[model samples]
Structures are given as structure tokens and as C-alpha cells.
Target: MQKITPSLWFNNNAEEAISFYTTIFKNSTVTGQAYYGENSPMPAGTLLTATFQLDGQEFIAINAGPQFPFTEAVSFTVYCENQQEVDHYWDKLLEGGGKESQCGWLKDKFGLSWQIVPTIMPKLLTDKDKQKAGRAMQAMMKMVKLDIATLEKAFNGN
Candidate 1:
């Protein structure tokens, strides 16, 4: 057991959300599920919690009802290798019911927000030349799901 596993609360789709997350990340899958028992908050057949692993990180989802919702204030950042990888995740995550926000941020179908960032973004934005870095940051601020190639082009003053 990990010392701490991030637990998420869902209205009623803990299982489905875990399945969807496992599919999106490599070496990931649902490990176990616990159904709501007698006297539990949810119905007997509904899920109380489900354990899942994504890229070696453990996560748990609980069908805790609609008291809380995911917000832009907190989101997971996926460091993508290239623009193709960024596009792939962006498209897949946005399908069905996701929405886009400015500056590489988006809310998936589950209302979970994520930041699909490029691996090389930090280096570009922290370049020795402050002006170049500033330009890159400015360009990134205008769009959602940052594109590596475009950011690079902006950094290069092109």
C-alpha cells in the first residue's frame, strides 16, 4: 500500500471513470472494486470505491455523490513528448463531454481538469533571454493544450 493515494469523488461513475483513466494511461488498470453494502451511502449495487493504477501511481475513486466537483484550481499535468502526443490526448480526453479552456487546460467528460503540457516547455520558457521566455509565455497564455512546435516557434522569434 502506498503511503498516500489520491482519492477522487464521483457522483456515480467511479467504476466507469477508473476504466476510462486506465485506458488513457499505459501500464494502467483497475485493481479492485468495492460495492456499496447494506446501510452504505450509495445503493447496494453501486460502487463505493474503486482502486486503479495509472503509470504506477495508485488512485481511488469513491461514489461520494455530488457534493464536490473538479475545478480548474487543481488539475493534473501530463508532460507529453511531442505535439502528436499532445494532440492525441487532447482529442481523446475532449471527446463525448469535455470542454476546452485557455492555456493548455481542459475539463474531461468527467469534469476532471488536466493540463496537457509539452516536455520541453519549461526549458523554453526559462531561457536565458527573458524576452524570449516572456514571448513564449505570452503565446502559451492565448491557447489551451499547449503545442510544442508552436511554442518552439514562438521562442525562436518566428
Candidate 2:
């Protein structure tokens, strides 16, 4: 068992969120779920919580009230191996009412913030050649969904 798992609080939509997430991530599964009972805040049989794994990372989601809403302060970063991976996640995560944000950040329909980052980002941003790194950084700042090709070109001073 994992030592710790990230827990998510949803506005009576934990099941929907779990379904959405499981479908989006290729390697994902719904491990367990619990439902509310009599005298509970929610109707009996309503989903109370769900435990799931995405790409081997365990997470538990609760069907809490609207008292808590997702904020950009906490975001999930999806490090992609290439531009294709980045584009795939970027498009899928923005499927419904997702909103785009600056510098590879976006908020999905569930209001959860996500960063679709390219794997090469760290190396480019920390290159020994400061000028190249700066150019790459500037190029990334101008993008909503990161483009690895553009970053690589900028890093190479092309």
C-alpha cells in the first residue's frame, strides 16, 4: 500500500470525476468506493468517496459539499515525454468546459488545475548557456499549451 495518497474534495461529483479521470488516463482503475447511508448529508446510495489509481498514483476523492472548491494554489503536473504526449493530455483535459491558462496551465471542467509540461522543460530552463535558457523561458511564457519543438528551437537559438 502507498504510504500517502492525495485526497480530492468534490461538490457531490466524486463519481463523475473518477469516471472522467479513469477514462482519460490509459493506466487507471477505480479500486474502491463507499456510499452514504441513512441520515447522511447526501442521499442514501450516493457516492461518499472513491479510491482510484492513475498511472500508478493512488488518489482518494470525497463527495463533499460546495464548501471547498478547487484552486490554482494546488495543481497536478503531467510531465510528458514529447509534444504529442503534451498535446494529447492538453486536449483531453480541456474536453468539456476547461479553461486555458498561461504557461502550460489549465483548469479542467472540474475546476482542477493541471500543468501539461514537456519532459525537456527542466533541462532547457536550466541550461549552462544562460542566453539559451532565457530564450526558452520566454518562449514557454508565451504559450498556453507548451510546445516542445518551439522550446527546443528557442533553446538552440534557431
How well is each residue in 27-121 modelled by candidate 2, as lDDT tens digits? 89999999999999999999999899998999999998899999999999999998889989999999989999989999999999999999899
Error of 2 at 28 (Å): 0.2
lDDT score for candidate 2 against the true structure: 0.94
Clashes of each: 3, 0
Tens-digit lDDT track for model 1 on 9-83? Answer: 897877778878888888997888888778877778888888889888998898888999877776888889988
Q: Model 1, which residues run further than 4 Å from truth?
A: none
Q: Which ten contiguous residues of candidate 2 have the minimum total lDDT?
A: 18-27
The candidate that wins on lDDT is 2
Supply candidate 1's per-residue lDDT for 152.
83
